[model samples]
Target chain A: MSVFIIRRLLQSVLVLVVMSMLVFAGVYAVGNPIDILISPDATQADRDATIRAMGLDRPMWLQYAYFVKNALAADLGKSFAFNVPAIELILERMPATLELASCAMLMAVVIGLPLGLYAGLKPKSFAGKTIMTLSIFGFSLPTFWIGLMLIMIFAVFLGVLPSNGRGATALLLGIPVSFLTWDGLRHLALPAFTLALLNIALIIRLVRSGTQEALLMDYVKFARAKGLSDARIIGVHVLKNIMIPIVTVIALQFGSVIAFAVVTETIFAWPGMGKLLIDSINVLDRPVIVAYLLIIVTLFIFINLLVDIAYSLLDPRVRLGESDS
Target chain B: MSQQPALSTATPVLQVSGLETHFAARNGIVKPVNGVSFSVSRGKIMGLVGESGSGKSMTGYSIMGLIDAPGKVVGGSILLDGREVRGLDAESLRALRGNRIAMIFQDPMMTLNPVLRIDTQMVEAIQAHEDVGRHAALDRCRAALAQVGIASPDQRLKSYPHQFSGGMRQRVAIAIAILLKPDVIIADEPTTALDVTIQGQILAEMQKLCRESGTALIWITHDLSVIAGLADQVCVMYAGRIVERGSVDDVLDSTAHPYTLGLLNSVPSRNPRGQRLRQIPGMTPSLLNLAPGCPFRERCAHATRECLEDPLLEPVLGHPTDAASAAHQVSCHHPLQTGIST
Candidate 1:
């Protein structure tokens, strides 16, 4: 198992290296931040001085080498716009996105699992059909549109929830998390729900289909024949088998949620890394963009590795280093 | 033939009469187990022999009350030790299953859950019906595994199903079935997927287990050789009904039903060494929209106008009325004469 983890870590390093080069090159291709960083009234002497100070005069490869060197030293360069370390800027907004993403994922699993199981168990029942139909709407509706509708209903008309921004937050483990406070949770509701809507639909479909297939497996029939109670059979036998696929999908989706919540963050004006990313992009903040992409890549690699380990854990047939049969 | 007085006098452990399991389809209701009847005495191994889709497995499922929706035991009286188990509520049926009766399925690979440890699966089977503590249940599971010829039961119990080979997996399933020492066990082709050597070993073990524990066993398979060696009584099923039933010797030696004769003739060992093996003519007829007649009429070489009429299960004529032959019955309008060789 340790060997498997070590191999995965090596692969992850390779992926990180490739991603860093791609991100650095991709951000470099974008128009220079110098245009936006300096004013039109600035003299050429001041501009040259600013460019030299920022090491903008270096060749592209040399700049990338410098970036890699600083990255290895745990310095991802300073944001051209914020003048703070890019990693620090991202980390400052990390808690909000992490909390929101986690809440959305938790909501999706808690709400979707039983409903999907029910739908699979009784595909012909009226309630099952209704839940499945509603899931379709969840999938088809755009995230931004859903966010707007939620705001309009609960915030605009009902006036119960705050329409925008993270409400009062308390420091927990030195990280400001909104969910710990009721007022902050109220502020979190609309955006989180909107974020979870698509994932809930995906989870429901995945679990429902998986459950349906699992119900037909011979082991399930054998379980039934063994005189096991319906609860034990469904809860342990059926649920464990279906969970293999669900775990992989949910983990990948969780990673995507944290990284690509830009639209939802923009709509709700939530102070998150996604929001920071958008603000940085508008000004061609190369350091923040490159850092953000590299971080997201790392997150995906980490999630995929975790998923492989979890997959092996869930299914006994999936050993660590056995060649594929 | 001298009758075994003990077999005739003892009360049967399980009796089913007029069993009918039907499935609803878009075309019409398909009768998979149509009016089947059989009884198994304690310590007896009854072989239910049939080709694929012969409703042999369905009969076993119906007895366990494991029939799913779209197919149900619509009519039947399943007397388990004199109590009618048919039409009982789910909870009541569940209580009897894996406790008083258990089942082993074909494809040992599929019978056990891939994700579960053998110990978890076995212990749960005991705890599901009984209030036994986990330690006691684990002890019982270990004993059961050892009884089924598995070595190092302690190590085998901890391993998951995938870690075991196919034969070993089937042994685990058998161990679980006998864990509760149920009154009856319905094994639906349990050894069908195994190699011949493994199949023979399991068959011998099952027969010995039955003899030792007085557990009535229903061994379902299409292999006549297996039935001849393992089962004391045999029931030949075709298209959802038992076409022939008798003592193993009487059924195999003086086969009455022409269909049974066809099955025996199709065996390569029974046929001439150089010639091509004989196969029963035609596919099994669809249960749906079946005409009111013998289901095998279309395939029987001896079929005539008389076979178009439904035939009742009746004793083969000219056979003595002794207790041994009395138990032998055939459901064919034109049963082949006695003393006919395959």
Candidate 2:
């Protein structure tokens, strides 16, 4: 297992290097940094001084080497648009995005899994049929559209919860780990629910199919023949078998949950990385974009690794070292 | 062999009569179990032999109350030791299953959870139906494992179902079934996936356990040879109907109905050794498009004009061992007789 993890880590390092190089080359190829140096406000002498100071006058290869070297040392360079260190800006925005994704995922599993299990247990019953239809609609509708619907309903029609932002009042909780609105769930309810609604729909579909398939397996029949009650049969036998697939689906989608939150954050003005990254792209903040891309990629790879480890824990048949048992 | 039908003799542990199960589909209803009737006394092993789609498995499921969705028992009287089980509530039925009656499926893995440890699953199974403590349940689980011929019970219990080979999985499954010490056990082709040697061992162990514990057993399978060796009474089903039923020797040797005779002759051992195996001519008719008359008439060699009308089970000719209540009964207009040619 340790050997497998070490190999995976080595492979990840190689992949990260290759990906960084590609992004660096593509960004460099798009334009000349000297163009940014030679602004309309600058005279020829000023432009020359600026180009030399920023090392933009150097050869492309030397410029790339310096960029890589500085990036490695955690100096992501000053963003042309923001006039601040790119790494520092990304780090400032990371917590809110992580908070939203984490809360949404939590909401997805808690709400969706139970609903799916209930539907699976009584497929022919009235409740099961209702849940199935709702999920189909949930899965079919677009996430952003659902988010808009939620805002229209809770914010506009209901007039109960706040539409957006962290909170009007200071939170009692020490140092918010997630979005200020979400960190204080009392205020965080609306935005979190808005983000969570689509994920819940997705998770419901995944868990429903997984549970339904597991319920039909011979082991389930065997468990029933053991005279196990319907609840026990579903909880222990069916749920356990269904979890492996559910975990994978949830893990694989976590990165997308983070990426897709851009639209939601923009609409609500929720100060998360999604909004930050999009704003950076609009102004063409090169350093910020690079840093954001690397961070998102790293998070995705880390989540996938966590899922792989979880797979071995769930089913012993899957040994980490060998492809085939 | 206690005579006088009374509650004193345990009321024939499982008495099934006029069991009619049909599948209601979009096309039409398919009547798979048409008035099937049988009774299994305590300490008795009744073998239900049938070909594919003969409703043997359905009958087993019906007894366990495991039938769900499209299929249902339209008409039946399932009595477990004189108590009616046909209309019992779900809770009552669940209580009865596994505690008083247990079923073993063909695939052993069906009975064993692939992800769970043997000990955990078995102990849970034990604790589910009984209020026994964990340590006591664990001890019982260990003993049950050892009883099924598993070596080093503790280590085997700790291992997952995948760690064990096919035969061993079946043994573990058998152990789980017997762990509850149910009054009745329905083994539906439990040994079908096992090796011949392992099959023999399992059969021997199962029979011994049933005999010793006085647990009534309904062994449902297509393997007539296994039934011939293990069963006390043999009920032969053809297209969901029990065409012939009697003692194991009587059904295997005499084979009064043409379906039974054909089924017997179809097997390699019963046929002439050097000659090509004689198979039953036609396939089982689809239940949806079944003829109004006998379901097996298309496949029976002796099917005649009279066979157009459904034939109730009747005594075979020249068997005057109590004609009113003979040991053998065959469902055919023309059963094999003293001078009737094959």
How would you encode candidate 2's per-residue C-alpha lDDT over A112-193 as one tens digit per residue? 9999878876778999889888877767786677767877887789866666776643433543453444335644566666
lDDT of 1: 0.91
Evaluate candidate 1 and give its CAPRI docking class based on DockQ.
high
Off by more than 4 A, model 2:
A30-39, A124-129, A168-175, A178-183, B1-11, B272-274, B320-325, B338-342
State which candidate has the highest lDDT. 1
Q: Which ten residues in a row have the lowest lDDT in candidate 1 chain B?
A: B1-10
Give Cα-based local distance difference scores for all models. 0.91, 0.81
Clashing pairs in 2: A166-A181
Q: Which candidate is the best by TM-score?
A: 1
TM-score result, candidate 1? 0.98
Superposed by TM-score, candidate 1 places the C-alpha of residue A195 at a distance from the truth, in angstroms, of 0.7
Clashing pairs in 1: none
* Residue-by-residue lDDT tens digits, candidate 1, A240-292: 99999899889999999999999999999999999999999899999999988
Docking level of model 2: medium
**Ten-residue segment with the worst summed lDDT in candidate 2 chain B?**
B1-10
